[model samples]
Target: MPKPAPGLPTREQILDFIATSSTPAGKREIAKAFGLTAQQKIILKAMLKDMADEGLIDSAPGRAFHKMGGVPKVTVLRIVDADDGGNVWAVPENWHAETPAPRLRVRERKRGALGVGDRILARTEEAGNGWIAHPMKALARGEELILGVLRQEGSKLWLQGVEKKERREFQVSDAGEGKPGDLVLAEKAGRPPRITARVTEVLGDPFAPRSFSLIAIHKLGIPTVFSPETIEGAEKIAKTPLGEGFGENGREDLRHVPIVAIDPADARDHDDAVWATSDDDPKNDGGWKAIVAIADVSFYVRPGSDLDREARRRGNSVYFPDRVVPMLPEILSADVCSLKQGADRAALVCHMQIGKSGELKSWRFTRAVVRIAANIAYEDAQAAIDGQIDHPLTDTALKPLWACWRALYKAREKRSPLDLDLPERRVVLDEKGRIMSVAPRERLDAHKLIEDYMIAANVAAAKALEAKKAPVMYRVHEEPSREKLVALKDYLKTFGVEFALGQVVRPATFNHILDKVGEVDFRQQVMEQVLRTQTQAYYAPANHGHFGLALGSYAHFTSPIRRYADLIVHRALVSAYKLGPGGLTEGEAAGMERIGEGISALERRAMEAERDTIDRYVAAFLAERVGQVVETRITGVTNFGFFATVEGIGGDGLMPVRDIGGEYFRFDEAARKLVGEHSGTEYASGQRLPLRLAEANPVSGALRFEMVDGKGAAPERDVKPARVIKRRGRPANIRHQGRKR
Candidate 1:
């Protein structure tokens, strides 16, 4: 057919031409291709000028043109990995790693002071083969990198810092490319004034198999693989037994005592052992003598040594479902320092006397040489105690140990600590390192026995040091703040339970609430709330008395092979008691404050890593079963959505308000619920509901759920609607509408 009337091209048509063109097309080329007349060409020129002004197209001198708005004016980026010629590459702050992020060539001057884990906001522009960026603001600059997921909201990107205690999200540069669910390594550029980040590298998707542990390990900057020097030092220490040079001298020989080690079945390190017997003294009638000997790690890993430094840096061993990242190398943690059965090992022993009432009468600390009479798991020990299983040492050793545990438990009961019986979920992995199942780890009497003994031993160590005026790092759990107590009282009022809030609330105060909740339907929910209100336990140079344990003074003095704090306590005991050569040095004593803070940070880091790994594995396990209806109890309710833990699997998922029917909901913080506007339906914490798994994104470690039961509000007389009145016309749950903005 003949050509129709020549007319000016629409914006869409012009854009399509430019996009489909083999190369960046100019005005003359566009006019000729579209068969525009001379008058139409004039109009086309004006349109091209307008498009250029609108950032729709880039017009260069001499008619060169290209697509515009490809590069952001400002974005956050990090120099992830160093390339050849000292050049480094960067990804966008909100990268999901769905694909490769845009490569950036930062100027040499801009790259100065920038290192891995350093985050920076920069101005970016397209250069010859890649984008060039000038870092305008340095957000955070540190040696440690943060591993987290990148999330995009409109044109802005945020890093959901996976650090356990960090609740605030940090802004990231948008220049580099990342999806919502990508695991990324980020860095802080300068300092506190600028709180932003740049994605240095994308680790992987959070939901991928085995990726969960990796993300946690990387995010927390946990040293999974030991350094060559640490490994070599550990290997050297392992080759020479501690008894050869470091043992026997000034050491009490406790090998004659029938001290047996109790631990988990899978535990490789036997750090502490217990021995108990009736005191035959008529003056001390109805009394028992108990001895707790912990592995002497300081005997091998001395001060300022490679192993010691690494252990100090790690703070404590991180236990993951797939594997363990030991504070010390395997040679020390699993062999030399491990108190194995019938093997002579050096130890820090506490000889304690307990009267008939389980009250500690007297205690003293000393260095010792001991041989573990037996090594038993918690399950086997419990079985023997229950008369279901028989062991060679059942009558002679196990029975006395059980009796000692019973007496100590009586003391524990008398103390009336905040006994919130929250069962911790344990992830069981198969041979291939995939999650087989998730279940609550049974808390047996044997477990409690070990715990009680450890507590007693720790207390003795603190007492010994305090008596000597030695500098000690106390495991302090401060009392709940006034604000937290007020919130707790308000929450308890919703359940028709009232707490006397004015007086000094002690662990005993929480125990009353916990005991009252045991028979309630929402026991777990109430326990969780109580736990949330309690302060986190951490090491401090000054004693602040542990509130949760109801202890006037406490310090971690068990499992020196796993915990650096315990190692320090061992050194302090040696120093205070003048036991031997491996004692706390003056330099270490002076720097105890810094060390305490550092180890406390590491402990929080490990907790975050462990929790994140579990979340990832749970997400992976449920990925294949999308759309299956599952039962869950709402654990948390916000304005946007409610979070629930899946009943059997124990995986937490978000049920967005938008998916909870058409009713607009309002968040009632006091009630911990979302109240529907028109429908009057409420989704509150502790409410059991059926949900269908709509999506499981392993990369993001996020699960989305849809409401299965279309149940409305509770019965009229039975329920008390929150005071928040619903409004008409607009939606009430606007905050929960969408995160992408």
Candidate 2:
């Protein structure tokens, strides 16, 4: 038996060692520092375990120890929030404690200013008042945190991902006091097969309706709660009244114009309104004069203000089935800035002269105070124009808008934009938060009328900025790359369609291709490929023409209440037209490139979160119909499996390759198809097949399908089996074999 050391450290001494250790202090390190014998080391291990049970010290990976409710001495920190005084605060990038993470005031060093969404390696210290962090060095932004549900299998705990595309489960290293079946926010710590994570937060039941969006909000790090300072600023701005005066204080009164706001019935905020009339001038006969009044958000949320900072961070409002996370506070987004009917509101108006051919002849911008004549829903406006409903505002508003749209449609047809029939699915929910129905929203002429007018206004804004030689944040969608177009051409050739690579591509080129394949079985498949071949749109200071709209100049000038990019354009117009206060500052113009990039990234973040929430809602709606057969169409094909979505109820499900039949299938990369080795059975994308709803996991939003006709097997052949091809460092099933022509 080994003898105990002469002196053993007290519990307080051990706690101090852990709290102040520069590196992860494990049991061996502690033993060496104390010069303890073998028996004394055993005693020290017992003490550490007792401390963990008592909730005094946390046992981290590699047997490291730290105080409960405390971060490591040197660890990664993410900037989360900032004060009105420019003091930034951060939290541990991978916090795993029961209590809320303690905010650390970052001490600005020579390293430079740290803004929100920045990551840094900092040395943390527990000060007398609170925690403080000093920058050691800056670090690149880390991977996004994972949101999942904790599940226990025997002695092991696992985190099941909530995203539809996440198929593998993560092994949990620390549960952070979370239990099985609890929704959690975790961070990845290790790689696959033995993938590990540490739980950072314990959210409630995953099956709840509100939890679906909440999961997405947290997963994407979306800012849901507004700062008190920002909210107060919005309220203060909302209280300022618009004085009654025409052409005074740089504001024009256009209250006499019968302007109308048309939007969705469920829309909470109305930001734009339109009015138009026939031109009486003989020289401009058959022309129309129009006004587009958008909410002047820049007037309220000015540069360098708390409200402006918050709006810029949010970029745009995120709309979900249950709620909307607005860019501005509700006091401004839904009440003050919103163009409510019979209410006087501040607006930035665009005046345009359109000729008979719908060509914009001239345009100007001005600040104005206008009263919205009426706020009509799209369905009601369409019904009124169809003579199905006798409405008072139909002749005053609906008919004139439709007449203007008729002329605009002529120009739109001449432009020939890349038109794709992509139907959007809408989820309807009851007051109790239960889903009522999920269906495709019907397209209407009323929607198109508003869209065309908005497009004209946006073009005018961009062109006006260019005339002033001012910086413009152009909405850019460049043409597809040669690689994608080549792949697309190969895919089309399978159907015997011709595509010339040497020709200069235009939106009309894609339109012609679709027209050639009109209403065929593979038209939807071809459309999907065309969409995949298009480039993603983004905002940039340098102008790159919008390929999708076929517009040489385009900027977002509508819906300033929801979009920050529109707000920036409004400020630019105010600056260029000398429309008085809230004009773009010199500093803002200088930083336009950086601002554009940041807002573009934020926009993508909002889109991803919104799409993910919708997927979760769809999965929840279909959870009750498991085991029933559903009509599905193959949306994509891969080496491992094929993905299909329900005909109407939209949620993609995977049909594994192994479950299809008892035969080896070879994947054709160029053709996007899979063929059985012996039976020669072929399955390709865009094909319709009946599949059974095998599995639907609402928590993960994952679905699995099976063939309704039962597993297919190849007939026995009295011949030698096909030669198996083996490749080093490749899976046996995924190895490609030469095919006989």
Candidate 3:
């Protein structure tokens, strides 16, 4: 509640009123606006006077005591209406704390705020006195705080404390005597500038804050972020192919594999396609067979051409909250080489065999021009498999494909393969790129068919490298790091499930754990956490074999369209076995190795940039659902808040530490939790709990979650458990957030 027309109301009430206002208003205006009366006015004036003493606010030039225009928006939102009415008006992210913590917080708006070149952290306060703030830590000792001060007001400085307050007359920090109003520059002095000051250096009024964030990102040179120049250069190199004249040099032809690609309904670039079935081919005893055809990107993207030069520079495509900074331009990623429906395109095909007993019978790799019979969405093909979607592809030719998918699933189960599949959440957007809704993306049987075949092809690549003794960069997924495993074991122990943390944890152990806990209510959360413990598998010359797929050897081979490594690997295989680039010069191999490393580094950065973009979209999606409570599973625990996997959405967000008001919580780094020092209030990782959706900022991609008792609430149950969704390059699609909330 806003202090009623301020008849000298309490500081608490005044603060609350300030927090609630969405727009800046005069003190008297606020009083009149909110209906503050007689004594309340007196009390409010005194409170504002005290805050003025603290340099938190300054009265407007030539303005009377009751008039407004002094409050620093940042501090106003800090303590005002922070409780009770909910911190609605925010600075664009969770919390207004001034700590060095990585979380975004509210900083102050300057004189020329909202103008070009004038950077200010935005803060919002509704008329109800609710406020939310995000802080910016840009000022440092000796650094310049450049700002164009717009207005000058008759404001006096007073020093104030809880019991007593006094006025103070001081000289202006700016060179000239601080006049009624003057834009001035404030350099950080002996120590870092105070976090509370709104105006640092007043540059001038006519300036802009437009695209300030992008500028900062570029200036800071954060390794993960990329510039437009970097993106532009890489795109050009992707257009020209390297080894062009060698197409007819004796590579095996599998142009008639009847291959099809099944990706998310929203996927644009198709990289890998599969045609799988029972092949009684006389190569060995009759067995199930797979022909995994990948878009032959290297065939067109040369090593040092303009296209290759840009590709080399970008390393890979970068994704941001609302957009994609593609490594290759749309000309390549989605067109020319895109394996779209009914397109006869060139590819590097991996022919593989799986025995009846769920074993890799045999495999072969070849490069050729292949035709895609169809391009189907994962769900559509899954519908075809489940008999829910009776489409032409299923009736005309996919029935046998369905059989192959079933066989692959069986092979996966019998092999005790590591099921690293996690739910995927898609953030749907409207025309202007605003997130309209968040929905879960399913992984159907048809998805498994493609996944299994890709795995086979990957293994084939790894095997070929091993056979020729080539120092190729393999996509090695080593065992979970010991530290991660220990933390995981501790987390599970809190749940009373003693996982065997012996000398080693094999893939089968995870599979076993999944089987044992699959029927439990909180199993979804547990499974994803277990999945998270596994380090992100990466490419290296040293083969650490992927544990998740239960494969002896593996490398990404079927997505050259989106991944540079796939292109390199495709070139290596073709040269080694087909076109004869057999032996590398010492210098050549070293150069390729160096190139691999560069590409790997860029790949990581691009992935981060992509995640950053997705995060922003998801944040926007969640912000629209304030006050909605959903059953959720705690996927991670942090000091700030616990992150949850909501039921239907494949996304994650934080349940902020401050919003969880019931008890003072501490995160147990060993086990990942926030527990009350007293009252035994505990929020454990992987615990299914009810989270009241509080705030989500799309711009910063931050989520604020609140935890409440979920005792009687039904545990979040998944309709179809977590599964990995592949989109043929960059980072894999990670869906989450449907843990019921």
Taking the candidates one at a time, how many backbone clashes does each contain?
21, 0, 97
Please list all clashing residue pairs in model 2, or write none if there are none.
none
List lDDT for all candidates, in order: 0.77, 0.83, 0.56
- Name the regions of candidate 1 deviating beyond 4 angstroms: 1-209, 239-249, 709-741
Candidate 1 lDDT (Cα, 0 to 1): 0.77
Q: Give one digit per residue, the lDDT tens place, for model 2 in 81-164.
A: 666666778998765455798899999884237766579999888888689999999998665578899989999999988876
lDDT by residue for model 3 (443-542), tens: 6666667777677678788888778776566776766756578767876776677787675677888877777776776677678778878766666665
Instruction: Flag regions of model 2 displaced more than 4 Å.
Output: 1-144, 165-177, 187-198, 243-250, 712-741
Model 3 collision count: 97
Residue 353, model 2, lDDT: 89
TM-scores of the candidates in the order shown: 0.73, 0.78, 0.62
Runs in model 3 deviating more than 4 A are 1-244, 247-257, 281-283, 319-322, 580-588, 591-593, 627-681, 687-694, 705-741
lDDT of 1 by residue, 1-741 (tens): 113336777887777666556544678778877788888998888788667645577543234465563434466776664544666556566332123567777775643455545567777766766787777887864446667788889977888865434657878864255678787887654344354787888876765556668877776568878889989988887675545544446567888888999899988788899989887788887778899999888888889898888889889999888788888888788877888999888888999998887888889987788999899999999899889999988888889878877888999999988888887888887787777888788899888888998999889889889999998989999887665778889998888888887787888998888777767658888998999887678787788799999999899999899899999999998888877767899999998877887787788888877877777677777887887888888888876678998876676787766667766677766677887778788888888888888877554466778777643221233322223344565324433322332
Give lDDT for model 2: 0.83
Sequence-dependent TM-score of model 3:
0.62
Task: Name the best candidate (by TM-score).
Answer: 2
Residue 502's C-alpha lDDT in candidate 3? Answer: 75
TM-score for predicted model 2 compared with the true structure? 0.78
